[model samples]
Target: MTTATTGDTTPTPRSRLLPQGVGVIADVAAVAALLAGGGRPIVWAGSLGAVLAGSYLLVRRLGQPVDRTAVVGLVVAVVGAGIFGYALRPSPPAGPAQQTTATPHSTDPTAGSPTPGATTNSTAPGATAGSPTPGASAADTPAETWLADVAAVDGGEGWRHGAATVAGTEHPRSVIGSTCSSTHDGHESFNLARRYSRFRSTIGMPDDAPNDAHTRFRVLVDRKVLFQQDLRLGQTATVDVGVRNGLRLTLEVDSIGTTSCGDTAVWGGAVLRR
Candidate 1:
């Protein structure tokens, strides 16, 4: 007589791996939903709960046994998901009740009136006319009159008005005068007619000028020189002269060297103030 052979009853590796793979996919989906919906607690919680419940039902329908360890793990996962979802909930918006309430002042008849010794206007004490007042708006302040904006009544051929760069500084409103060997001197005169009381400008040679280039700059009131300076390629000077009661305002530039190579002078930020 021959012995009867029996089929193997042990579970295969693939059978175990299939269930584990399904569980892992479900877990990844839950975590993704939680992270993606961090600001929406309801979306995160609902998605995670639905995925876990579906996974459990699917496993049960596949004839998988529900053990004590699996049941404990499922409970732990749900509790942890709830805690994280609650923690990641968005904060409530601020309402009118949460706003800061200012304290009410006493109901006195003279409460809003100006006190004695208090200054009403924005200008400070002893502030002169045409001067910039403290805390004054742009409308209240006097507008600047740039000399470059005005047409010169008498100007040399080399005189130019517009934007220019001097000593590596930019001047949006400027007047430039050039002096060469053919013309040793350049001048530009504006008819102020005694309207302006102060004149301000920065005098310097153009940055593109030769290193040895030297020139003399002069500011004159009614043909009288009020300010003068000799400047080199990189030298600069500030001209703040009083042109009070002056009829004519003139700017002159003269080449100091015999060659006068690159003797380009610039009057940067030239303005007349009243």
Candidate 2:
């Protein structure tokens, strides 16, 4: 008697594709859905579920004529597999970080410290509002410091009394000079007070001194130009500048004399509110 040995064979490529077609379709559809309108998080979730179900259905069809019990078991297995795959995908990129740094500040009027971008100060009582804190660098002071310094000066037009030394101008003057100040006068509900100066050419012969006979002036705040004008002999003009909540101000006397002469200038003292 002769005996023959037999064993079950694995699925051929064509046979395997038949059972996996639904899964392939599901994966394609899911990716397409993501590419099209998956920006909303819910879309990804729903698509994943649908795709996994389709995969299971394709597999079940290959084993058709199964009993109810087998169908139930297949459904359970598909659900478990889908959940595992979803949990395993790599997470998306994170969003930009938010600013969490708290600003440092001092409370004394004269107790301010200079920081990179802005001045840090606290409005503590009786802190010598006019004096700049030790931390203030000549260059790093804020606009309010300029305003306060200007107010302390003896110019008729407040901080605007500095002289302008612009070249080529016949009557250059320092209306406010180089000063800093702050003010709260003539202000409405809004913080709209101004600190400015009025300068006239020195009323003497062109003594070869600065502003001997020049006739021009400029107004500035924090080194920012607010107004500039050329003056005629014996003529007087005025400018009105607007200030916000802060009193920081800057007034400067730019290069003076005609273009032929090299630039020469003078700056003034600090001014604050009256």
Candidate 3:
């Protein structure tokens, strides 16, 4: 005659540290964008929403009222959820099945074997009976190579993001430039008059600063002023620019070479050929 059991105690609501303060500012802006060099993939996915809002505020503060920096930000949200569970782990599972190595032929063609169409388009080494196949010439036919090397094209100087590739020094293509700005003068305006006016290279400080500091290399076409110079530090100035037909070219460098982001202007070997 006894049937009345209902122990319904219930009590679990507490989780709101505002997702542990937005997952500790998205895990410190994804560890400062992974120490600066990585792009912010939405701040590394906000460090997994700050480790699921610090595991729902550490299970609503287990024994209650927590705060030693909220238990060191819930141990940096469980070490950023085990380092994003091994940095987003996943790959490895497509196609993958390639391993080949097979070679062993000798069907005894008359023992010393030597008669499969007698092999000969007169293969090299003094190719007899009339030689001269090494590229068979229009005189080897390959000479107009520098058709364009302006920082390798598309309006070159690497579209300027602090453009600087003065390699082996003494700048040639060694200069694609920018100096951030300071009244201005680091230029590169383009358009070599299409009809293909020549343009070798060299303009300022590189070939290892043969000179440094005077900065003032100019050149204009449609607007007139052909080529101007003033380089100095260690000295550099061999930009042979030639123009003829319907054109428009202007290149100036003079952010002044010292400050104003050290302009150092370049075009060192910025070619444009026939």
**Steric collisions counted per model:** 0, 55, 19
What value of lDDT does candidate 3 attain over all alpha carbons? 0.52
Model 1: per-residue Cα lDDT at residue 72: 41
lDDT of 3 by residue, 154-257 (tens): 23342342223454453322345544445443455654434445655665643333343456777766667778877655555677767656345666565454
* Candidate 1 ranges with C-alpha deviation above 4 Å: 1-143, 181-185
The TM-score of predicted model 2 comes to 0.25
Candidate models: Cα lDDT each: 0.69, 0.39, 0.52
As a whole number from 0 to 100, the lDDT of residue 46 in candidate 3 is 58
TM-scores of all predicted structures: 0.47, 0.25, 0.20
Q: What is the lDDT of residue 256 in candidate 3?
A: 56
TM-score winner between candidates 1 and 3: 1
Error of 3 at 27 (Å): 99
Which is the better candidate, 1 or 3, if ranked by lDDT?
1
Q: How many backbone clashes does candidate 2 have?
A: 55
How does model 2 fare in lDDT?
0.39
